[model samples]
Target: MPAHRYSELHTIPFYECNVNNRISIPMLINILILASEHQNEKLGVDQLYLIDKYGIGWVVTSYSIHITELPRKDSVVKMTTRGTSYNRYFAFREFWLHDQDGNELVKVESIWVLMNEKTRKITAIDDDVITPYQSEKVRRVPRLPRPGRIEPEDQMTSKEYQVRWSDIDFNGHVNNSRYPEWMLDSLPMDFLDTHEPTNIDIRFENEVKYGNRVTSSVVVDSSDNDKIKTVHEIKSSDVLSASATIVWKENKAEGQD
Candidate 1:
């Protein structure tokens, strides 16, 4: 079956933007995620329906994102998403953000799996549960590139964060969008203000529960003048929960552009 696409227009809110007046990465991800959830609702497969019917909910496993530029605060943009395909265990989805003139600003490819809410374990995706999206079914699972790991030789810095109640989503775990925020928070403010991520690759390994104190470790490499790379790992009690690598480019000064 052909894939179904859903799209919406969004005005980037002030709260979602960073000090540079561009939409922040984590909130931008949240917006894209909401678009997908909205699509599922339209397909009669929303989270409430899934959990109530099959005791399962959608969990994101990984995301690969590329950015041409970030939309500024109060800017109207079009966000589009679709379920590309699915296998026995994994589903592939795509998302895109375009400016007012239809110029592509960001593109993302993501992988998702069904998790049993009670067991907190991966559940086999039942045909009926996913067929509503009209995604193609295939026997072979798709392989997404894994995020780069932190190297033993790399110098690292760490930050601790307490998972607040607000961070929990309907899935009862730390929202996937918050993972990036935690990872990014480990960086220096000067770096964040001057650099903007151009590419980000992140993978979630374990679910973090409320009240858990998670540690984010990061290693930044600025050897290349053109682009800076940062590798990150998030752990709770030394158990790896997530990891990511982000490539950034220095932004021009506020008034220069």
Candidate 2:
């Protein structure tokens, strides 16, 4: 079977960058999703097509991203995505972001499940769906480092946010990319300024609908002063909606400590 990777070029706009002028994690995810969608469209299996033809849609179950560097505003980067493999109920996808000079800036792996749009039930992935992507069934899919479970004692800070209409996707729920934004916003600005996220792992537990409110909680682990580990939870009406873990490294310029 031929390889099925797809690539797209993007320019990091000013609005996608944070105050520090680096691309925000949430925006990076959005770019990756866009790349994946473009590839799916080429394969005739994009979300809209799936929902229309099969009454099913792809829903992300978990994701892990490793960041080597974040592109600065106005920087040109290439984003690529491909289907790695699949099983009866799950599909594995991989994404990468490369700088103009061909250095990899970000790598991500995600697990997705096909859900029946009308019944909202998990569905088996059809062979025809996987065939176009040239993906094979794998006996064991590679797993990323799992995010630590949150404990009662670890809850350090919490903030509540209302889901806006704009946050709602075609599926009538808050977009998966928005969870990371909510999680990151719960952190102190000082910490965001002093550190940059190097790794992130997130699991989606429940869906948050439009007009619902989500409370994001943050727990910090200071075992290593140089490296910070933060655990996050997004709760809706006191029920867990999603959870995440983010690892950070001190923000320093090239050749600086």
Candidate 3:
């Protein structure tokens, strides 16, 4: 495996959290993306660098983030990442979340695939990029199941967009956090402006790139007045990039009926 790279420390802001004063799932994804970008930048082999040097693209085909303890606003947090291994078509990475005192918070694992820019087809990982990592060998057992369940959602209320330049990450793909921006944008302004998300579960299935037209769909359940359930999905044509479930809790202020 490659020598350990630096783990960047990031502070949580109130806006990063849902109405519950805890980090939002989407924001957490952003943290991971940020850590990965920071590590690559430090290594001098970051995403854009990779693309400009090589005529290829990388997409986060899968991600599994386990939220152990949610960090609150102003909480000092640390994100650690390591390139684990690669075999055949997959490159693996592991991430750990730590609190200020060095207590473990969350653990994450992900895999990404390289693609040809012209054809937009997934290609194998090029040695030029993978060789430096010298990643450890990982067993191949048909990796874990990814998050993909296709069901029609309510008519998307909000169509706010994320420009190509703004959302692109070091990998030349839309950063994971951008998914949440599309998801939340479809939500009622009143909902996110005042409430917070209690929990969010999402799976990264594919990568949507610059100039890719993405549509956000949401389905909401109103079983309880105080709590609401929402599902957010981002798609291009028939292929899905990611799907998310967000649970919202109203602010603690009086009269939120």
Candidate 4:
């Protein structure tokens, strides 16, 4: 088969949106994961095959996605992805989201590290995997900004969510990815649907236990418009649970969370 690169599409549904009837953070994350699965098919490996064949997995270390518009219920959105390059431990990939009419909606670039299953350390992507994709080396690298932080004394907002039995993973705690839900959940309805998040750096600080009430809050720095930073913090009293920053595009009216 000839080696080629192509982008696939995914549609947004009503359940994917939040109270604002806009696409939620969790749904956005879910869409990207699905897009990657299809993109891998073009490279002779879907998500499942890649994980199983190499005993290797791709984890998102950092990502920045700018959303120009929200995909409404039953609206079809097209997503295109490409492996831009690989520099040792960092593999660069770009994804573009668009309307069926071909208007670009969101642009995302993500950095990932390949990991060994049992040892859980960074590893190299072999030539076999590398050669299949016609990728060029990204010469000029753009530095991503750091995620935000919240002080211990900072006043915070809270949300009480029951750790349903289904939310518990094999590790016996709420899935780390679920924190984005709690984080974004703290934002306003208009903010959830609009605004493009130009940057977002999330670090998992700790695990959220089942049946525990996790309060969430955000810290915003009003200094720069080129980049808007909002910190997502999940905590109990003074103890921290997890934190994330959603960097918005110049337009703050769209994504408040």
Note each model's CA RMSD in angstroms. Answer: 1.4, 2.0, 4.9, 4.9
The CA lDDT at 28 in model 1 is: 89
- Measured on C-alpha atoms, candidate 1 has an lDDT of 0.91
State TM-scores per candidate.
0.96, 0.95, 0.69, 0.74
Off by over 4 Å in 3: 1-5, 14-20, 139-142, 151-175, 184-201, 204-215, 218-231, 236-239, 245-257
- For each candidate in the order shown, give its overall lDDT on alpha carbons: 0.91, 0.89, 0.72, 0.68
**Tens digits of per-residue lDDT for model 1 on 1-257?**
58899999999989999889999988989999889989999999998999889998988999999999999999999999999899989999999999989999999999999988899889888989888888888876567678888878889999999999999986678988889999999999988988899999999998899999999999998898888999999999989999998999889776255
lDDT of 2 by residue, 1-257 (tens): 75499999999999999888889888998889899888989998888889888999888889999999988889999999889988888888999999989999999999998999989889999997789888868876677667776797675799989999999987798998899999999999888887899999999889999989899999999898778899999999989899999999988762232
The residue-by-residue lDDT of candidate 4 on 84-165, one tens digit each, is: 7765566777778889889987777777767665566779766666566665545543444446778777665656666677
- lDDT (Cα, tens digit) per residue for candidate 3, span 1-257: 36455587899998897766778767887788789778777766777787688767556666665655767778889889877787768878778889999988877777877777767777777667766555665666236444434355443443535448878865567877788778887887777766666556567777788888888878776777867877777887658778877666665562333
Worst 10 residues of 1 by lDDT: 248-257
Look at candidate 2 and give me any clashing residue pairs. none
The collision pairs in model 3 are 18-196, 18-197, 19-195, 19-196, 19-197, 47-170
Ranking by lDDT: 1, 2, 3, 4
- In candidate 1, which residue pairs get closer than 3 Å at backbone N, Cα or C atoms, i.e. clash? none
- Sort the candidates on TM-score, descending order: 1, 2, 4, 3
